[model samples]
Target chain A: MTVNELIEKCGFNAVSLPEPEREINGCYIGDLLSWVMGRAEADNVWITIMSNINIIAVATLADVCCIILAEGVTVDDEIVKLAGEKGVNILLSDKKTYETAVAVYEAI
Target chain B: MSESLTFHYDVDGEDFTSAGQASVQVKKNLRRLGIAPDIIRQVSIAMYEGEINMVIHAGGGEADVIVSEDKIDIILADHGPGIADIELAMQEGYSTAPDSVRSLGFGAGMGLPNMKRYMDEMTIDSTVGVGTTIKMTVYLNR
Candidate 1:
């Protein structure tokens, strides 16, 4: 499924949808940036509570289709702008990380 | 190779927010050079981990990417209290990073292992009081 389609179905708040049409092939849930960097596959929907700017770099490097900030985690304006500029999709989810992953799994 | 390109950056240790800037730029540079996606990912992810290690442990460092016809070479040098035990440091779950860095989503003790996982060759030259320099090479053909 595409990012926009998943967002529509899951009711995820779109913080940065620079590549809304990007495909979501799978889901990866992790907070450790280094571990996620290696384990998360390209185009996977990454679910995390990491709100720092480094998350943007990790998303870009891992080439994930989008990042789902779980557990009501919210990033500042600077991060949203950076995600948009770097072409990394950012979505906000009120669910926990596991629930967010399950939601993505069901949607895609 | 006779022809090559080199990119250098000074990693700032003071700000954790800017830790991965060098790797991010390296990714962009590799993309512009038309490097393969998988190869670029390998190089960038490896270098990004190195950058984070430099900041969290060494307070900053120098990173250089030398791109050639056959391989991409990354050199990360830091002037901080070096690793005393290379063997222990390479372990997946061993980390010396402070709690502050751990809260930032790093300090998971997977940095060096992750670097080695992506790169074709890795060498660590560290002295406890002096410094540490890591050289990693990723073959283009791989």
Candidate 2:
């Protein structure tokens, strides 16, 4: 699914979008960076509650399609800028992490 | 190419946030070299897990990546309390990391297993109270 579709389905707001056409290969929902690092596939959508710049770095390295910030978490502006520069999409939601994951899982 | 390309990185033990930087760079470098996407992802993910393990468990370490025509090899060396049981450590969900590390989204005990999973060959050498050295190789050819 496209990022926009995911946002609409999950009731999330697109905080930042590098492009509307980045393909979503799959979905990986995890807050553990190490676990996600090992399991996340390139072009996969990563859903998590963490809001650190390292997320951006990981997304860049893994070539993930986008990151959805669950649990209504906020990120540093630099992170948004970095995501834009790296061409990774970032979305935000007010739902709890588990709820967001369930929604995303169901949508996927 | 006759000459092998080598890259070395010194991982910081205390910074969980900054971990995996080297692996990211290596991934970019491999991509630039036109390596296969599958091979690149395997190498990058394996190295990234190792890097996080070094910072979380070993307090820091050194990583060396040697890129050759046929394969990519990664050597991770750290001077920390060595693993008492290599077999036990290899099990999934076994971790020695503190609660703080877990709160930061690590210490899942999947690092070594994932590394071994993606690499074609892997060797682990450790001495109690001494250190640990892991060598992993991923072949370029399918």
Candidate 3:
């Protein structure tokens, strides 16, 4: 699946720019930056409530396919712009973290 | 086996966001060396956990990675308050990190265990008031 497919399947409202085609593996659900830094794999969907730029750093380091900002959290515009620069797909969801994770899994 | 490459990093304790930079670099180095993705993940995760512990528990630390044909060895040394009880600290779900650290998505007490889990061999040396040093190795052929 792709990031666009995930957003469509979950019926998540796109609060930011849409994503281009990217590969999707599985989903990793966690907010612990260090844990996700180690646990998240390349081309995986990283689900978290963290909206910090460090989250973007981790996503870049882990090479995640897309980041799902769960719970409708708002973030600085710079993050989304940086994601575009880094070729990482960024999406936002109004659903809770767990529900978003489940939706991702079901979509996969 | 003799190491083909060595990388050393001085981890800054003040920057929570930069904690895993060393691990990220190491992962890239290993990937350029044509190491398998699984092996690179193991090395990166083990080293990243160590890096986080250094920033969270200790003020900061030093990390050294030696890469060779047979294995990769990571040494993380910190001058922060040492572990009081190794046994208890090793137990899952036991954490002493402050609330702030948890808010960053850590302090779940899984850092140490996850490091140990991903590495083939790990050793911890610490003195209560002195400091702590962790040495972890991931075998290339494993």
What are the per-model numbers of colliding residue pairs?
0, 0, 1
lDDT of 3 by residue, B11-103 (tens): 999998767778878888888988888888778777877888898889898999998889888999999999999989988778999998887
Worst 10-residue lDDT window for candidate 3 chain A reads A12-21
Docking class of 1: high
Off by over 4 Å in 2: A8-11, A96-108
The positional error of residue B124 in candidate 2, measured at the CA in angstroms, is: 0.8
lDDT of 2 by residue, A17-92 (tens): 9876777778888887767877888888888987877787677767788898887788888878877876779988
- Taken in order, the candidates have interface RMSDs of 0.7, 1.9, 2.6
lDDT of 3 by residue, A19-91 (tens): 5567799988888776785567788999889887767657766778888889988778887776666566778
> How high is the lDDT of residue B1 in model 1?
47
- Spell out the clash pairs found in candidate 2: none
Computed on C-alphas against the true complex, the DockQ of each candidate is 0.88, 0.61, 0.45
Return the number of clashes found in candidate 3: 1
Q: What is the TM-score of chain A alone in each candidate?
A: 0.98, 0.88, 0.89
Residue range with the least summed lDDT across 10 consecutive positions in model 3 chain B: B1-10
Better of 2 and 3 by DockQ: 2
In model 1, what lDDT does residue B27 have?
A: 95
- The TM-score values for the models, in the order shown, are 0.97, 0.89, 0.86
